[model samples]
Target chain A: MVKQKGILYDSTMCVGCGECYSACKKQNKLPETNSDFLKDHLSANTYTVVEQHGDLYARKMCMHCAEPTCASVCPVKAFEKTKEGAVIYDAEKCIGCRYCMQACPHQIPRYEWSQVSPRVRKCVLCQNRISKGLPTACSEACPTGATICGDLDDLKIEAKKRLSEGSDKYYQHIYGLDEAGGGSVLILASVPFEKLGYTPNLPKQPMPQLTNRVMEKIPTVATVGGLFLGSMYWLTKRKNEIAREEKEAKFKRNEVK
Target chain B: MKNSNASKLSFWKIVAAVIMICGLYSSYIRFTKGLGASTHLSDSIPWGLWIGFDFLGVGLAAAGFTIAVMVHVFNIHKFEPIVRPAILTAYIGYTLVVLLLIIDLGRPQNFWHPLVMWNLHSVMFEITWCVICYSAILTLEFAPVVLEKYNLTAPIKILRKISIPVVILGVIFSTLHQSSFGSLYLIVPGRLYPLWYSTLLPVNFYISCIAAGLSMIIFESYLNARAFNLGLRLDILSGLAKIVLYVLIIGFLVRITDMIITGKTPFLFLPRTETYMFYAEVIVGTFIPVYLLSQAKYRKSRMWLYVISIFTLSGFVLNRINVAVTGLVASSKTSYFPSFDEISITMMLVVLGMWAFKLVSTKFPVFVELENLKEEKLPEDSREMILSE
Candidate 1:
C-alpha cells in the first residue's frame, strides 16, 4: 500500500526568506509573478506564497483536504484526490465552469482568465516528487526546516509533539488538522491561526459531505416524485373522463326528450 | 395596437437589428480577447452579470412545467389556451441559457463534455442533465403545435396520447434543476452574505420560482392577446393571479422564518449593499406584488395585472443578483459590475429571444387551438375586470 505523504508547516520557524516560494516556481515552471514575494497572491501562475503576519510568517497553498470540495463540485471530475494525498487536476478534462473556484472553502483555486482555453490552477502538492519518494518542492527547499515532509501519521505525531513540548511557544490548535475534516498539510503557529490570516471556525465535517448528504437523497426524490405525479395523472384523468361521460349522458337524454 | 402590427414590428425590428449587430461584435471580441480582457471578472469574482442573467432566464422559464402540470397532469383544461405560449417561452428561455453558458465558458469547445462526463455529486451536473432532459420534454410538448400546422395528424395523435407522461417528466426535471440552481450556492456559505445564505436555499429557490413562473405566464398571456388581437381570458388569468398571491405569501414566510430561525435577521439590519438589495428583492418581488395582488381591482384589471407581473419579475431579478453578486461583495472585498461587452451580449440575447417569440407566434399555431373557450365570463365580484384594455 502507498503510504500517505504529508507536510507540517511550523510557521514560527519560518524566517520569511521565501525559499519555498521560489522552489515551487522552479519546480512547476511558472513564470515570475512578482519581484517581491510578500506582495504576491495566489494566481494562475503563482501557486504558493510566503505571507508575513506581524512577527511571524506562513505559506499559503492548497490544503489538500482528505476529501476535497473541488473534486466533489466539478461536473467533469477534473480534480482527483490521489493516493499520495495530493489533490491533482487534469486541465485536459476541465470544462472551465469554475465551480472549484466557487466551492473551495479556502478560495485557493485560481483561473487562467487570459487564455482562450482557461484551466483552474492551484498547487498540486508536488504529486510527481512525492510519488517518486521525494519530498515536496517547498519542503525540500526550506532551509530552516520549517516545512517538513513525511507520512501523514508521522507528521501528525510530530506536530503534536512540538505543540506539547512548547505549549507557551505555540497556539494550542493545529490549523488544518481537523479544519473542514482535516488535510494532509497541517500548520503550527505561534499566534492564533485566525490572527495569522488563516480561515477559522470551519466545521469538522468534510466540506463535500455537506453537499453529498442532500445529493444522496436525489434518487428517492426522483422516484417518489415520478410515482406521485404518475398516480395523479391517472387519478385526474379518470375523474375528468367520468365528468365528461356524465355531461354527455345528460345531453343525449335531453335530445331524446 | 394589435391592428397596428406592421408599424410596431418595423420599429422593434430596427431596435433589435441594432442590438444584434452590437452583440455580434461583442461576442467576437469576447471570444478573441478572453475573459480577462472582455469582462470585469477576476479570481475573486469568477461569476458576474452572465450568471445572474442565467438565473433570471431559468427562473422565468419555469412556466413551461407549471402550465403543463395544470393542463395535462391535473386536467385543469381551462389553462389549455396559454399552454403553447408558455412552452414556447420555456424553449426560448432554455435556448438563451445554453447560448449564454457557451459565451461565458472559458473553453466553449468543451460545452458538450458534461454530457459524457458524470459527476453525480455535483449540483451543476445534475442541473445540466435536468436541463437537457427537460428541453427534450419541452420539444415533445411543443411538437404538436408545429405538427398541427403541417397537417400531420398521425404524429400529433401520438404526441397527444403521450402528453401526460411528457408533462410529468418535464415537471420532475424542472423541479430538480430549479432547486439545484439554488443548491449551487450552498457550497459557498462563507462567501455568500448571511442574508441570502441558508440551509433552506433549495426550498426558497423552488417556491420563489413557482411565483416567478406563474407571473411569467400571466405576462405572456396578456402580451399574446395584445399581439394577436385575441380576446383576453380574464377568468383564467385572475385564477392564476390568486395562485401567485398564495405562492408569494408562502415564499415570503419561508424566507423570513428561515432567516429568523437561523439567527440571520441580525445580518438583515447591517448597512451593506446586500441588505439593501435584499430589501429591494422582497419589496418588489414579494411585498408589493402580494399587496397589489391581494386587492380585487388589481388582481382583475388588465393594466394592474401587467404592472404587478413586471414588479414581481423585477424583484426576482434583484434577488438573483443579490444572491449571485452582491452577497459576495463583503467577503470578496471587491465589488463587481459587468463590462460593456458583457452588457451588450446579454442585451443581444434577450432581443434575440423576443424576435424568436415573434417569429414563432406568427409562423405557427402557437395559440390557434382555443379548444377551451368556456372562459369568456368574468367572476361576478371582480369589479372593473375589463375584457381587453
Candidate 2:
C-alpha cells in the first residue's frame, strides 16, 4: 500500500513570495482575473493564495481532510479521498446541489459560478503530479523551506520536532493536526490561527461524524416507523370494522324483533 | 353567479398567463445564458432564493401527510372532508418543488442520477428518495378523487381497500424528509449561526412543520369557501385551528427549551440582524397567532381564523428563509440578494400552483357536497361490509 502523502507549512519561514501562487495557477491552467494578488482572496480562478497577516504570511488552500465533510454530504459521491491522501473531485458526477459548499468546515471549495456549466473549484494537493512521483507544484516552487511534502506520518513527527525546538516563537500547536478531525495538510504559525484568518474553535472530532450520528438512524427509523405505522393502521381499521359489524348486527336484531 | 364566477376565473387566468410567460422567458435566459448571468448566486453563496423557496414549498405542502394520518390512520372521520383538497395541494406543491429543483440544479439533465447513485450517508440523498416516494404516495392518495369523478368503481374499491397502508407509508416518508431538511444544516455548524443551529434541529423542523401544515389547511379552507361558494365548515376549520394552537405551543416550548439548554438564549438578546429576524419570526409568526388562536372567540370567528392562519403561514416562510439565508450571512463573505429573474420565477411557480389547484377543484368532485353524492350512490353500511370481509 502506498503511504498517504501530506504537506507541512511553516508560516514563520514564509517570505510572502508569489512563486507558489503562480505555480498553482500555472499547474491548474487557471485564467488570471487581473485582481491584485495581495488584496484578492481565493476564488474560482485562484487555487492557492499566500495571505499576509501582519509580518507573518500564511498560505490558504484545501485542507484535504482525512474524513472530509464535503465528500460525506455530496449526494452523488462527486468527491473522493484517494489512497494518496488527496481529496479529488469528479465534476461529471456533481449535480451542483452545492451541499458540499455548505457542509465544508474549512469552506475551501470554490464554484465556477460564472460558467454555463459550472464545476466546483478547489485544491487537489496536486494529486496528478503526486501520482506520477512528483512533489506538489506549490511545495516544489517554494524558495524557502517553508512548505514540505512527504508522508503524513513523517510530517507529524517533523511538525512536533519544530514545535519543541522553537517553542518560544511557535504557538505550541499544529493548526490542522487535529482541527476539523485532522486534515492531510498541517500548518505551524507564530500567532494563533484565528489571527491568521483561519477559522478557530473547530471541534476535534471530524465534522462528518456529527452528521453521521443522525444519518445512521435513518434506516432504523424508516423500517421501525414503517412497521409501527402499519400495525397501528391495521389495528385501528380492525377496531372500526368490529364496531360497524356490531352496529349492523344490533340493527338486524331490532328489525327481526 | 355564473357571470361573477366567470369574471373571477378569467381575471386569475390572465394573471397566471402573464406570469407564466415571463417565467418561461426567464427560464430560457437561465438555460441559455447560464446561472452566472441570470442568478445572483456566486461561489461564496451557491444557494439563494430557489433553495429558500424549495424549503417553503415542502414545509407548506406538509398538510398532505398530516391530514392523511388524521383521517385514515387515526380514523378522525370529521377531517375527511378536507383530506382530498389537502392531498391535492401537496401534489401540486411537490410538483412545483421538483420543477424548481430541476431549474436550480447546475446539471438539470442529471437530476435522475440520485436514483442510481446511492450515498446513504447523505441527508440529501435520503430526502431525494423520500420526495420521489412521497410524491408517488400523494398521487395514489389523490387518484381516487379523479377515479371517483369518472365513477371508476373497480380501482376506487381497490384503492380504498389499501388506503390505510398507503397513508401509513406516506406519513413515514413525510416525517423522515421533513426532519431531514433540517439535517441538511447539521453539517454546517461552523457556518450557520448558533441561534439557529442545534443538534435537535431535525426535531425543531418536524415540530414547526406540523403547525405550518395545519395552518396551510385552514388557509386553504377559507379560500375554497370563497372561490367555490362552498360555505366554510367553521366546525372543521375551528377544529384544525385548535390543533394548530396546540402545535404552536409545542413548537415554541421545544425551541425555547432547546435554546436555553444549548446556552443560545443569550444570543437571542444580541443586537444583531439575525437576532432581530429571530424575534420577528417567533413573535409575528408564532406567538401572536398562538395567543389569538388560543382564545375560543378568535378560533370561532372566520376573519380571526384567517388572520391567524396567514400569520402562521408567513412565519413558516420566514423561518425557512432565515435558516437558509440570514443564519449564514455572518460567515459568508458575500452578501446575497436574489435578482429580479429569481424572484419572478418563484412568483411564477406560486401562481402556477394556484391555477392548477383552481383547475383541479373545479373539474373534480373536490368539495364535500359532491363527495356526499358519491357516498349516497354507495351506502356507507355496504362499504363497511366490504371492508370487514
Candidate 3:
C-alpha cells in the first residue's frame, strides 16, 4: 500500500484570513458562496470554510477518516478512499440515496439539491494535486504555514513534537488523531476541539465498524431463520396429519366392533 | 339492487378521480422540479415524510408473512381464508414503497444501481435484497389462486409443490427487512435522540411490527367485511386479535425493558414535543389496544375490535414517524413539516392502493371461503357472477 497523505492544521497559528477558502474555491472551480469567509459554512458549493471563534480561526472540511462511514454505508459503493487517504466520490455511481449523509459521523457530504440530477458534493482533498506530488490548495495558500500537507506518518510525529514543545500552548491532545478511528486530517488547537466547533465524544473505534458488526450477521441470520421456519412447518404439519390419521383409525375400529 | 350498485360504484369512482388528479399533479411537480423544491428537506435534514412513510408501509405489510406463516407453516387453517387478502395488501404496500422511493430518490433513473452494485456492509443493501425477494415470494404465494381462476391446473400444480418452501422464504425475508428498518437508525446513535436509540433496535422493530401488522389485518378485515359483504367468522378475527394481544404484551415488555436497560428513560429528560409523541405511541398505540383487546367483551364485539385495531395501527404509525423524523429534530436543528407536494403524493398512493385492492378483490377470487369456492370456480362463470354483483 502507498503511504497515506494527510493535512496538519494548527488552529493556534491561523490568522482568520480567507485565503485558504478562496484558494479552495478556485481549485475546485466552484463559484463564490459568500463574500465574507468567516460567515461561510460547508455547503454543496463550498468545500472548506474558515470559522472564527472569538480570536481563533478553525478550518472545517471533510475529515477523510481511515475507515469512512460514507464508504461503508453506500449501497452503490459510490464513495471510495484513495491511497492518498482522501475520501472521494463518483457522481456516476451514486443513486442519491443520501444514506451517506445520514450515516456520516463528520456530516461532511452535501447534496446538490437545486439540480434535478443532484450529486453529493464534498472535499476531495485536492486529490489531483496530491497525486501530482503537490500540496493542497488550502495548505499552499496558507501564508503562515498554519496548515501543512504531507505524509500522515510524518505529520503525526510533527504534531506530537509540537505538542511536547509547546505543552503550555496547546490542548495536549491532537484532534482527529483517534476520534472516529482517526482521520487523515490532524489538528492542533489552543483550546479544546469542541470549543472550536468540532463534534465531541466520538468513539476511538471506527463508526463503520459499529454498523458492520450487525451487517456481517445477515447471512447467518438468514440461514438460521430459514431453517427454523422450515422445521416449524414440518413439525406442525406432521403433528396435525398424525392427529387426523389416528382419529380416522379409531373411528374405523369403533364401526367394525 | 342493480341501481344502488351502479350509483355506489360511481360515487367511489368520483372520489378516486379527485384523489388521483391531485396526486398526479403533485407527482408531476415532484418529477419536474427536484426534492429540494418538493420537500422541506435540507442539508441538515435529508430525510423527511417519504422515508418515514416508507417505514410505515413496510411495517404494516408485515401481516403478509404473519398470516402466511400462521396458515402455511403452523397449520392454522382458521387464518387460511384471510391469507390471500393479506398477501394482496402486502404486495400493494411494497409496490407503493418502491414508487415512493423512486419519487424520493435524487437520481430516480439510477435506482437500478443497487441491483448490480453490492455493499454487504450496508443495511440498505440487505433491505433492498430482502424486499425484492419477499415481493417475489408474495407473487408466487398469490399466483396459484390467480392461475386457478383460469383453470390452469398445470402451473397451479407446480406452485402447490413449491408453496411451503416459498412461504418459509417469505417469512425469513420479511423478518430480516422489517427489523433492518430499525437497524437503519442504529448507525446514527449520536444524531438520533437516545430515547429511541438502542442496541436492541432491530429486536424492538421486529416485535413492534408483529403487533402492528396483526392489528392491520384486523383493521383490513372489517373494511373488507363492509365493502364486499363477506361474513368472515368472528372467531377468526378474535383468534387473530388474541395473537395480537400476546404480541403486544411481548412487544411492550421488550421495549420497556430495553429502555430501562439502556437507561434512556424519558424521566431523565424534561418533557418536550417528542416526549408527547412517545406517550401517544406507547399509550395510545400499545397500552389502550392491549387493555381493551385482552377483555373477552371487547375482543368479541365487532365494533370494539375495529376501533382497537385502529388505535394500535395509529400507534405504529406514530412510532415509525417518531423514529424517522421527530427523534432527529434536535440534532438537525431545523424543524420540518411535509410540503404540500409531499402530503398530496402520499395521500395519492394510499388512495391508489385502496382502489387497486377493490378492483383486484372484486375481479379475482380473493375471499375464497365466503364465495363458497371449495373447488376453484370456472373463471368465465365467476367473472360474470362477480360483475353482475
State the lDDT of candidate 1 residue by residue for B78-188, as single tens digits: 777788889999999999998998899888888888899889999989988999999899999999889988999999999888887788889989999999999998887
Model 2: fraction of the reference interface contacts it also forms: 0.69
Every model's DockQ = 0.63, 0.68, 0.58
Question: For each candidate, what is the lDDT?
Answer: 0.88, 0.87, 0.87
In CAPRI terms, model 1 is classed as: medium
What candidate 1 gets wrong by more than 4 Å, as runs, is A248-257, B1-11, B369-389
Error of 1 at B69 (Å): 0.4
Writing each residue's lDDT as its tens digit, candidate 3 over B1-389 gives: 99999999999889878888888998888888888888888888899999998999999989999999988888777677788988999999999999999899899999999899998888888888899999899899889868878999999989989998999889989989998999888888789877788877898899988888888989988888877667755677888888889988898898788888777785446678877878888898889998998898998888888999999999899899889998999988789999888898998999988888888888888887766743333332121111100
Predictions ranked by DockQ, top down?
Answer: 2, 1, 3
Over the stretch A1-257, how does candidate 1's per-residue lDDT look in tens digits? 99999999999899999999999999999999999999999999999999988868988999999989999999989999999999999988888788889889888999998987888889999999999999999999999999999999999999999999999999899888898889999999988888877887788889887678778878888899889988887897788777777878999999999
Query: Clashes in model 1: which pairs?
Result: none
Interface RMSD of each: 2.4, 1.7, 3.2
Judged by DockQ cut-offs, is candidate 2 incorrect, acceptable, medium or high?
A: medium
Tens-place lDDT digits, model 2, residues A54-161 = 888989999999999889999999899999999999998898898988888888898877777888899999999888778899999999979989989999999999
The residue-by-residue lDDT of candidate 3 on A13-84, one tens digit each, is 999888889999999999988888899889999999899999988999999999998998899999999999
